[model samples]
Target: MDNNSILLIDPTFDPASASTCNLLVKVGLDSFSYAIINKETKQVNAVFDEQECDNGAQKFAERLKTDSYLKLPYQEVKFAIHTANTIAIPNDLYNEANLESHSQFFTESHSGNLYCQAQNHFGFTTIFTLLRAIDKTLEEFTYAKKYEQNAGLIQLAEKLDGYNLLLDFTVASFNVLFIKNQQVVFQQCYEIENTEEFNYYILLIINQLNINLQETALNLTGIINKGDEKYHCLLKYFSKADFISVDTDLNQEVLDDMPAHYYSSLLALNQCV
Candidate 1:
């Protein structure tokens, strides 16, 4: 395994049984990860993660061509691509006929395809864009379902109650979702190059949301570790900061040597549907 990659496979996993498994893939700005889980038992069979990817879509396409595990036919294939070109509009104000115009108001200049997903419980619709290359790569799989990174976060946040701030981090980017009283209040993705930039965003969020750091529970997951600079930065203000544990039936032995929180957001993709 490469220094920047993580590979965990259950000894009992059978490639032939992949037809009964659901494949979940998360393509981040600088990372790529996938997990296989049995549909009925909800047991994770395998997980592979590669970080600091350059030209992520191309790299993923290459892996699909060569990686035996990825070539297996699964019962369902779901993709969650990370993108900053996304906007949420109130359902009452959302106009499907004007999707292009509505998306143009928020998304940056891009020649990608536009798509929309309704968050009925939240009373809004999310309009997002996916790179054409990424879309083309996904075509390799039959009837593959596509979604943005926020979809998984929303699914996980729906289960929580009261003041909660969820943070999903990557090597250079992070996704933030703030839920209060079982309702989503704010959510956005940010790219940071250093600890200072990360701290700036945290402080900005606190001021804008009027968040009581001492009272609000800060639940974190993804490429962050305890005692790291970023983690330490968060502890400075939020007294209730801690890593989130995903609620799922997984093969514990496969993850025995790794931190389960590292795959929280990725594993949450199973709850997207």
Candidate 2:
């Protein structure tokens, strides 16, 4: 192997499935990662990280040409867009075709080039715009919303009572999905530099939503470890805060140097697609 190679992979993993396969690519603003899974067993065949590339669209196309899986027939592709901010609204009031009007409430202002689409989840509509990180050449495949990937988890959290917070973090991005009384109340992503800033945002959401700190439940996933400062910080305020469970048959050796939990949203796309 070349010491200067940029590819990071687990040599022990042999992602081969005789049946049809699905590809989930998380096209984030700063990070790009993908996984291929068996459509029937839902087991991850392979996981790849594009080792910090700025030109994702170009890399996406080039990789397809070289990656053996891309040539497989009946292979489906799903892209989870994190660069585009997300918001959940009551379906009755949301208009999919007139999304630009709702931009006034988005953390980002709407631009002429921005396009939006809405998907329904448990009676609520998740409206989000797509990020252009990937080149238009690969637009042939259908792109699913990142919020769709979180729908199953959010609904799972709703099965219980009180306030539930789902925090999904990546290499540089973090997403917050708040559920109160079994209803999605808030969903947004935050960019953080440290634990203190992360704490600040959590508190801000709690206060803004008027959630009782003593009764709120926090379920975390993505890029966080049990003993890490990021994990402990949440524990300080919410003593009952815990990481959400993921269903995987992944070999631990393959994830030796990576945080297995951090890929929750991406893995959840298996159900989303």
Candidate 3:
């Protein structure tokens, strides 16, 4: 599927899941939006958002299904139970030593595919020019660069192998694959948060596993409140750790048009490939 791509849309309207393992759909409950990328023209054929309709997805789909923008034959569509973001955890049992362990948390499910959601928030035809920039590179990061340097504060600082960490404060989710000698040794889900109990949960994993923090790279994908100073402060404690924000960049015009929820979906979509 070179010219065309298959996307598993997770259109979640409900906000129930809140752990690391459970599937989540809604990134920003109030922010609903959608977009149409024309692979042929390499532009956003159309865009829409929530304000357009009391119910966004159904309305947008009805309109597009009728007109068939791009005319590429809307191939397939299905709603999935999107998974929560994961993080590598550390042990808190040995407070003095700060040991680590492995465990997962999750969040609730959302409703509706984000594309249609985008349309609901922004006008369907407003961003036609910008959507053409929808290339894979724009959506993913093999290594973190475009993301703010502050986002990498943890990665720039930490060295933890066999230690566990939890992410509780975030609104997203991810999977942590532990690689040793260039091979996947283990994989687990982690939820990084600001709660003391969650922090202890991470330490519990470290202490119980009896692993050293000298050699570990924690991989994560999910929605992070970069605007929150609290998250930055907590990150300061994780010196010797590496962190990356995995998400796509909507052209400035698109960003201005879409709702808040689209950000995480974009991040999740970037990593999905």
Q: What is the lDDT of residue 125 in candidate 3?
A: 10
- The digit string of per-residue lDDT tens for model 1 on 1-273 reads 789888899998999998999899988877888999988777888889898787556668878887899888899888888776888888889999988878776657777778787777777888888877787887778587778877777777777888999999888889999988877789988888999999999999999999987769898888899889999999889875778877766655667788878888888888776
In TM-score terms, candidate 2 sits at 0.74
For residues 98-184, could you state the per-residue lDDT of candidate 2 as single tens digits? 876766776665443344334344466666554454435445554433333344355445445767888877545577887777777
**What TM-score does prediction 1 earn?**
0.92
Please say which candidate is ahead in lDDT: 1 or 2: 1
For candidate 1, what is the lDDT?
0.83
Report the C-alpha displacement of residue 208, candidate 1, in angstroms: 2.8
How does each model score on TM-score? Answer: 0.92, 0.74, 0.34
Worst 10 residues of 2 by lDDT: 1-10
Query: Would you list the C-alpha lDDT of every candidate in the order shown?
Result: 0.83, 0.61, 0.29
For model 3, where is the 10-residue window of minimal lDDT?
121-130
* Candidate 3 lDDT score at position 126: 9
